[model samples]
Target: MKLKKLVLTGAAGRLGSYLREPLSKLCDELVSTDINDVGNLYEGETFIKADLANFDDMMGVIEGAEMVVHMGAIVDEAPFEELLGPNFVGSYNVWEAAHKHGVRRVIYGSSIHAVGMYPKNEFINTEVAHRPDTFYGLAKCFTEDLGRMYWEKRGLESVHMRILSAAQVNNPRALGSWLSYDDLIQLVTRCIDTPVTGFAVIYGVSNNDRAPVDNAKAAFLGYRPKDNAEDFAADVLAEADVLDPHDPGHMCHGGPFASVELGNSGLAGMNVIDDRKKS
Candidate 1:
């Protein structure tokens, strides 16, 4: 079923860039919104400059859309004041606007950091309580709860995808939590196409042999991840020898996000592989 219109926030972001083309194929019109202008677009794709923090701006972008893919925000752990606008308030605006416009569903890019405080040794499912390790993670938790409330009150459906790792596999942690680009597209497509998801949380991970999270509850969504991290496991393990178990970053599911101090950069020692496509 092709959608009448689909709104994708954070269109200029790395993941969002990849989503535009694919999502455009699934809808009559794909309206991509970001703080900055995203020049040159795919067929049936349009760009909208909007501020995530402003409720009116968010409403403007989402109006006349059947579904929304919310990916806009401060993508890291920052000071409370800094996060309030983009991460916290921006999220509120998205939900509020979606509700007002009568959108059917919101496919949110949630993070594993929402439950980052949990030890890596313990494998948890979607039902596990949130133990956010940072303010960024806290924001995700708030949105998840908000999604639930909206579903209960109004008839809005939301699927909070607790993404483990969506970057190129470069470290041992990713060997267990990696989500490849192809798999990500499939996951989002399933989230959007699924007919009756009423406020649900699902882990976004590939079919990694050593994956630490479970997605059994979200079987109805039919997200069968094809990629596996084991392909790069040997290289990652060879490079990441003698890890410090005492470090929370090494011990927790959140990886570097759990170890970083509050209001500090989580990208400190993360040698992330930026594989964002360059046109």
Candidate 2:
């Protein structure tokens, strides 16, 4: 199925920047929205400065779009109060707007933190129950439920892509949970073009040798990730210090996020440099 008009939230985000060009190749028109003004625009793309929390503005902007790619939210792990408005309410506005506007499918950016409380050694599939590690993870859990409810009750086809990690290989943990930008684009493309989809929850992990999750559901979505993080293994491994398994950073649901003091730089502590921008 050809997706004609597409609405992409979080258009100014790290991953969204990478998706701008590739998404345009598939759709006749790409309506990219974000709270910030994304200066440079691409061919066949329209950048609209809009917030995901504002229901009226969001619905107005997404009126004519046939599909919605919901990506706008506070990315870092934060206090519950900080996550309520943007991550929680914002997700609700997106789905309600899509349903009200008669959009067919919603491609969501789910996270590993939704099930972060599970032990790293225990291999998780999409079927596992949610055990949110932080406020950020709790928000992800909420949206996944929202997506499922909307699909089962309202007849909206939804795909929750449980992205394990979408960043550069920084340390030892990332080697086992990396989701490269190219592979991400491939995953989103398949989610959009798949002929028939109900409520599908699939892992966004790449073909990593040390991957924590088993993506046995690959046949369901036909997502064949060609990249791996083994090339960075030696360097990342050597750079990372051996940690105490009992430490919350190692033991808690969100690793660093679960260990870091609230309101601290949880993302910064992870040492992720999201340099997905162009020169």
Candidate 3:
């Protein structure tokens, strides 16, 4: 089940850093790339500095790779003009280069913000129409369609992992949306090892009692998450703020993203911890 080469974009990022060690073991050579250098490397891993917005850079990084984990991007919401190169063009470059190089599949880090406008009470599935909360979410929607088109038109495979909350479970919303790091690794592993996923979409969420999204349609991928944010519910809820019933930030699936102004930072209000994995 090992690949000859696996490319991981955003290797210097928080989630990417956590993945480097595991992904390195999944392949003979793990080619990790990012705009900045990853300070250290794991066994069977090598780092390459590359910008996602540049097609030539992406092509060179992806060449000879069996699978690509496309995680590089300006993670927070920003002006469409500012995000145009990194988020929009970057995804296009990855898909196009993977297509040109005959790569097997792309496992993308899609987000819940892609359908952030949906009410938190209403459980949505992968097939729901896009209701992006920000330009960042819009970019996710765009890449998802891009992945679908690539699979249908060129026979390239893709797995769009609509990650909910891959952060610390510090708030009430996270009790339903959290995707723990261990679960994140498992989700990506399933995407890579699944035998024949032509074009699939899966919600990257843990087995929480209050999970807001359904992954039944993507059962073929065999991603069964283990952690539950409910473990942190007692402490988090004891110090929780009273809910504003009228606020979309509390009522919508996007959480803070659903209420943030366009081009504003959604992470700013989230109080997400800086927990990037160290080499």
Candidate 4:
């Protein structure tokens, strides 16, 4: 079943870039929006430069859409004030606009930081309580609750993908947390195509043998990840730093995010590559 219209926020971002073409194929018209220019457009895609924090902008972009792939947000830790606009209020605008417009579902690009303080060995599941590790993580938790409220109160559907690490596998921690681009695409596609998801949460880690999270509760979504970070484990582990039993960065689910200061950058130590797909 194809959607008549689909709205994708953050179309200019790294992960968003990879999704534009594929998402365009899922709907008759893909309305791609971002604060920055989305450059060249795909065959069935249209670009709209809009801010997620603006209620009017969100309403305008989401109008006449069946579903929303909300990928726009600051991916790193920053001051609460700085993140307030794009990360916190922006999420509200999206959900509120979707509700007002009667959109079918919202597939949010949430992060592991929302539950980042948990020990890595725990193998947490979607049912675990929130334990935000930074302002960015707190923003995720807020939006998740917001989604839940909208679903229970207003009948708006939402799927929150708690992405662990959607970057290259360069370290030992990534061996268990890495979410490959292919698996990321598959997960989003599954979220959009699912028949019914009143309000759900699912880990975004791939099918790695050493994955730190469980997705059994989310089996209803049919998101069977195809890739694994273990493929890069040998090389990553060969150059891995010695284990630090007490360091949150090494022992927590959020990796660098769990160790970073509240308002500092978590990506600084993550060595994430710039692999955004070109238009």
Candidate 5:
């Protein structure tokens, strides 16, 4: 059944922009909210300026929605104070508001950094305990547990997608961790349309031959990703010189995030392009 109303947080963000058009087509009304204005929306989409950390504002944005696509948060490592409002408290507000408003489900854009400290050589699954490499990753761990508690207690459903990486494949890490935009949309769609997903945690990765994480436990969600980083492997590997295997940034599942000091910038050493379309 098509959703009557769907609310998407972080509407002005990179991934959020990619989701706007596709999600707008899946519902009668698509309410997109963010801290900044997302000008000139699609046909069925409407934008709302809201703050994620403010409980009342989050409540207002999510009220009456059947499901919420929560993509709002600080997407990198930072001081606890900087992340406190947007990444930590913001998540709390989103979940609490969803509970109060009786939203059926929340499709969270979680990150693999939640368990990022694990070695790249070790293949882990959703059931693995979190080994966060930074405060940003810690926030993901907190929210995943939050979702589980809510589902077990309040009957609200949620899907925590532990995304390895979502970017244009350009580097060696991306060759194993990249999740194409098309695959991301399909993953979100499967999470939304699945009949009975009870607080499930799924890895948001394509079928990369060198993928470090396992998604076998989440098979019930029916998310069969169609993209593979191997498509770009030749170019990426050719341009990439030998990496220091001793470096956690190259040897850990978190990539650059694993090597950075706490409260440091994870994007500092990596090369990723911003591909969000201009509105």
Candidate 6:
């Protein structure tokens, strides 16, 4: 695996804070980007503040990097107007800039919401068609298609990760959705190191017993997550009454996001305890 330079967007968010250090090790230089200000930069990283919605800013943030881990975005169910700028336009800007900059790969931080309308019991695979549950999800779909187009027409490699949940499992549903921080790192690292990944849409879920997607297709990437949510099940299950098993949040792909309103709770509802950089 070539240790090429990496550019990481959303450097200040929950997942990015966890990913900042380990991901920094994968590259000769890691340009950590976010709209917010951060302190105590990592060893191999340089911080850059930029709006994802701005094409010029996005392009400038990604300049000179060989690959990008696009984790920047509004992370919840927002109104279409709210989503258009950061979620939709930002995604396009990132891909377009990556193409123009001669960058080789883009590892997208796609959400499970991209296929959120699918039934919960269906045990979806990578082969399933997108059934987005929210406007936020629709944007993810757009990027996946953009990735396919870029790969088909321009030879740009894209690895779209349908991240289920990149934090601690807080409820009964998350047993299936949970993706530990270490696992998230492992998944992204695999996406980065794997040679010749021509526009693949893989799940960023864990090795949980109740995992919905069959990620065997992307198994060659060598992302074998070591963590499991079963340990939290005994306790969390005791608190959460088993749902109707028919409601979309309980029985469909979006989980809580299926019922959430525009700009309502999503990751904001998770019991994610995000810690900052260690001094």
Q: Specify the highest-lDDT model's number.
A: 3
Per-prediction TM-score:
0.98, 0.95, 0.99, 0.99, 0.98, 0.95
Candidate 6: regions farther than 4 A off: 2-4, 267-279
For the record, the alpha-carbon RMSD of candidate 1 to the native fold, in angstroms, is 0.9
Model 3 Cα lDDT, one tens digit per residue, 250-279: 999999999999999999889799899889
The C-alpha lDDT values of all candidates are 0.90, 0.84, 0.94, 0.92, 0.92, 0.86
3 against 6, candidate with superior TM-score:
3
Instruction: Report the C-alpha lDDT of model 4 over 119-234, residue by residue, as the tens digit.
Output: 99997898899999999999999999999999999999999999888888888988888888898899999999989999998888899999988889668989888888888978
lDDT by residue for model 5 (9-87), tens: 9889889989999999899999999998888889888888999999999999898999999999988899999999988
Backbone Cα, N, C clashes tallied per candidate: 0, 0, 0, 0, 0, 2
* lDDT tens readout by residue for model 1, 129-152: 999988999999999998999999
Residue 276 shift from truth in candidate 1, angstroms: 1.7
**Clashing residue pairs in candidate 1, if any?**
none
Tens digits of per-residue lDDT for model 6 on 148-238? 9999999999999999877667787789888888899899999988888998998888889888878787798888988888889889888
Q: Which of the two, 3 or 4, has more lDDT?
A: 3
In model 3, what is the error at residue 128, expressed in angstroms?
0.6
Q: How does model 1 score by TM-score? A: 0.98
Instruction: State the displacement of the C-alpha of residue 27, model 1, in Å, after optimal TM-score superposition.
Output: 0.3
- For model 2, what is the error of residue 70's alpha carbon versus the real structure, in angstroms, after optimal superposition? 0.8
* Model 5 TM-score on a 0 to 1 scale: 0.98
Comparison by lDDT, 2 against 4, better one = 4
